[model samples]
Target chain A: NAGVTQTPKFRVLKTGQSMTLLCAQDMNHEYMYWYRQDPGMGLRLIHYSVGEGTTAKGEVPDGYNVSRLKKQNFLLGLESAAPSQTSVYFCASSYLTPSGGRQVEQFFGPGTRLTVL
Target chain B: GIQVEQSPPDLILQEGANSTLRCNFSDSVNNLQWFHQNPWGQLINLFYIPSGTKQNGRLSATTVATERYSLLYISSSQTTDSGVYFCAVGDYNQGGKLIFGQGTELSVKP
Candidate 1:
């Protein structure tokens, strides 16, 4: 089964251009997250959704927006992309169970590499 | 906000050697996980140890929740094990959002 998949594995955008990255998960998880990975910065959260129709701001949400219109799909939008926004983006999902002790392990998609010129 | 820090920033090991990586976080956490980002850039989940200890094959991890630190032990390292390891914490107050550490880049030479 395809656990998590991201669309547009690679993209090149000119400054001020708009684009969207799509993430789809078949795990039927309730939590989905969007993160950007920069050299030496690890992975910083961009935005996240607890479930369909719910979204929240993350550590780095200034230049990005997100929508969880469907339960299995999470979308990240860059309205006016800049060179500084260029980074590898990742989408992850996890199943939150009622049990307390076990940590919810997140399943990540391959990643989307964006280059802004 | 809770902050996460990973030690050694970078490490180099010869094949079949052993190494350890450390992660420290400020404040309490509900959950924590370890991920290995391969050279191809795929983030693979390695462990989900919020506390206590766990082992799998040549890898093992220990989390001292009370001390706010975690350690990952890699035994018999191979060239294929070269990658960046990241520690992420999940806070209940943050709706289970994960805060990631800077990561420790590992290079295993043949």
Candidate 2:
């Protein structure tokens, strides 16, 4: 399985610019998430989707929006980028059903490095 | 919001040495996972141990859910183990919303 994959491994954008990050998973996971990683901040969830056609705000969802139109795809959108949004973005997916364990482990992507000027 | 904290923000060890990393959470959690972010920036899930102990190769993890903490042990480490190790927790009340810790940076020298 390809697991989880993210597009635009690296990007550079100026203030007020807009961009969308694409995440796709072949594992047929029921849950998908978007997270941002910054130095000394770990990985903070930006948004998540429980399933297709469903999305919810996460801990840090102010400047970001998400859409999950299909079961295999999740998109993160930054309408107006800001310098503070310059961080490594990660996409993760997990299955809700128990698989040998009660806790579901999330599989992460390679991460997208975004730099805002 | 539940808070997660990892100890020993930085670690340096010889390739053959052993090390222990810790993660402490502010509240009770029903799920906890350990991950290794390689130099290439790939977050690889190491263990999904919310409680009890589990061993994989030269690595092992133990989580005491009642105490709200977890430990990861690396034995006979190798240069390939150089990376950041993070622990994330999800409260049972929450719908599997995992919160991450700052992570412990490990540098194994050959």
Give the winner by TM-score.
Answer: 1
Candidate 2 lDDT score at position A117 = 100
Assess the local accuracy of residue B50 in candidate 1 as a C-alpha lDDT between 0 and 100. Answer: 90
lDDT of 1 by residue, A4-90 (tens): 999999999999999999999998988899999987778989999988999999989998999999999999999999999999999
* Candidate closest to the true structure, highest lDDT: 1
DockQ of each: 0.68, 0.66
The CAPRI quality class of candidate 2 comes to medium
lDDT of each prediction vs. the true structure? Answer: 0.92, 0.91
Q: What share of the true interface contacts does each candidate keep?
A: 0.72, 0.62
Residue pairs of candidate 2 with colliding backbone atoms? none
Tens-digit lDDT track for model 1 on B26-56?
A: 9998789999999999999999899999999
Prediction 2: B-chain TM-score: 0.97
lDDT score of residue A66 within candidate 2: 93
Q: After superposition, how far is residue B104 of candidate 1 from its true place, in Å?
A: 0.8
- Lowest lDDT sum, 10 consecutive residues, model 1 chain A, at A96-105
Model 1 residue runs over 4 Å out of place are: A98-103
